[model samples]
Target: MGDYASQHSFRIAIVGGGISGLYCALAIHHHCTKAAVSFKVDVYEQAPEFKEIGAGIGLRPDAAQLIHNVGLGDGLTAIAGGSGDMLYRRFDDGGEIVTVPLSREGSVKLAPCARSELLELLKGGIESRGAATLHTGKACQRVEGLGDSVRIHFTDSTTADADLLIGSDGIHSQVRRQFVSDNATFSGFIAYRGVVPMKSLPQWPLPSYSVAWLAKHRHFLVFSISSNEALNIVAFVTKEESQVVHTKESWTSTCSRGEVFKDFEGFHPSVQDVIKLMPEEVSRWRINDHEPLDRWHYLDGKVVLLGDAAHAMTPHLGAGGSVGIADG
Candidate 1:
């Protein structure tokens, strides 16, 4: 912010190319173009190609508004699904316990979008504007602050320098380590997630509304995505923190359908029916979150953290992605 008006160009380096990273890149371009500030953005991703590794993501009203403000309203509307009430039901008998409205009158309703679709929208936004240079397969190994600039060293022995560095990397962020001492801790919760074709569940009685079948130590969330063509299912179970031997490397793995059934035994028959329709191989995720840090920036504002890298909480509220969008 210091005398950028006189500068011919400003450089930004983003260490990750996930949802927040791509959205941050697009937002920067939108603002800089409006303020007449010339800037260059470079995004480095560790994966061989840009891809989102999840099923569905919920965009709260505020996050949807931010995307609209960033000039991607049309694209968002194209991919976003209708809003619905969230019904909580007893797991044993499937009796309704409560209904929570997910949309407020005169406000943008909560949007259900496939994670991959949203990622594509963000990538298309950047591509349409030609706003930033994207480098794939370049994992950030470490970072060094050089007075007025930051230098990023990647695993491939490549390096890049920029006036500022932003870390939109997910929960396991390399840049966040430069400042914070604490790492992401296992939340003692594991989730089995997968999508089932609606055609397979023709007898599915639930409406298009989001549903949460709850029990003492477990819960199963079911919502429609992909224009109601599929049902996105996430079944969570609590286990002793010490009992589960997991690492970041084993954060996500594929498990057999029987594993999910064993954890969710004795659930309502309707719930079991939905579970039976899940793909033979379901994704097992070891849920993790951070113990909020006192600070998220370093090198006197030259480096910053956003999204899950900044505050990775449980997905109970479905605000993780939305909050990350706001962080941008």
Candidate 2:
């Protein structure tokens, strides 16, 4: 063992409870157990419980393999909506333009999962290990480094110390601000996302296919999630046509149904029908991305950044969350 490994017990503090944080804890626990290293891990989340607000996410081959390696393959597969080819369609008439397969022969298969369901699986995996403890409703206000250890201050007038800290917080991460002194840049685009019952749209295409429609400057994506029980929909619009006000107060804002319909007035009838089914209230958030940092660690490598806090990307590739899973 190295000099740092000579400590009585190594402690790791994870600053977020999202996919990245929970998965990181599981990874560290499994790795240290395999090496017979004595260590303690804790995950601090601001929310009351583990949850994901987004509609759906696609896990690439690498991510799936990582999950399997972490002993979550069976649990994840149980709720996974099997993956297939992605189709690109014309926006005006919903005509198929091209099809792209997401998996190859004799290779790790791609999987699509509801964000919340995946979170639940990760939470269960960590709990089953009986190693790390989760601290909820503990918002990290600031973090400080003291020679060989780091101390984190929370809003509840409490603090915790650790040998190392990992910031898996999201784009608006408080940890990233203190450690990296950086902020996420607005991508000049916004997305409207939500999920609806698959039964509500009986005339739609088969639930197995994931579809994307490309217009001049906007696009719409639809896919099945929750074992084909619900359909997830996302529509992107440029900043020009849809002006986003109140730039800094909050990222998400509620809009009326009429507003959404007006944005897609010239869209295809099929697209129009889907938009109409959307509830009266919808939430829109500004898309933000950042350039890759040359370095992601601080305080003599005692702190690190992961996921959106480190390298946020546009959703056009649909691999943002998967990238974080890979990092774990």
| Best by the lDDT measure | 1
Candidate 2: residue pairs that collide: none
Clashing pairs in 1: none
Best by TM-score: 1
Candidate 2 local lDDT, 220-252, one digit each (tens) = 888877776777888888884247764332325
Which regions of candidate 2 fall more than 4 Å away from where they truly are? Answer: 1-5, 103-106, 206-208, 246-252
Q: How many collisions between residues are there in candidate 1?
A: 0
For all candidates in order, the CA lDDT equals 0.85, 0.81
Q: Please give, for residues 1-328, the per-residue lDDT of candidate 1 as tens digits.
A: 4455247479999989998899999999999899988899999999999898668887888999999998887778777765578889999898989988777777766777888989999998999889899999999989998887889999999899888899988899999987777888889888888877767885757654488999988999988777767678888889787755742324267778998899999999988898888878778888898998788889999999999999999988889899989988
For candidate 2, the per-residue lDDT at 211 reads: 84
Q: How well does candidate 2 score on lDDT at residue 28?
A: 91
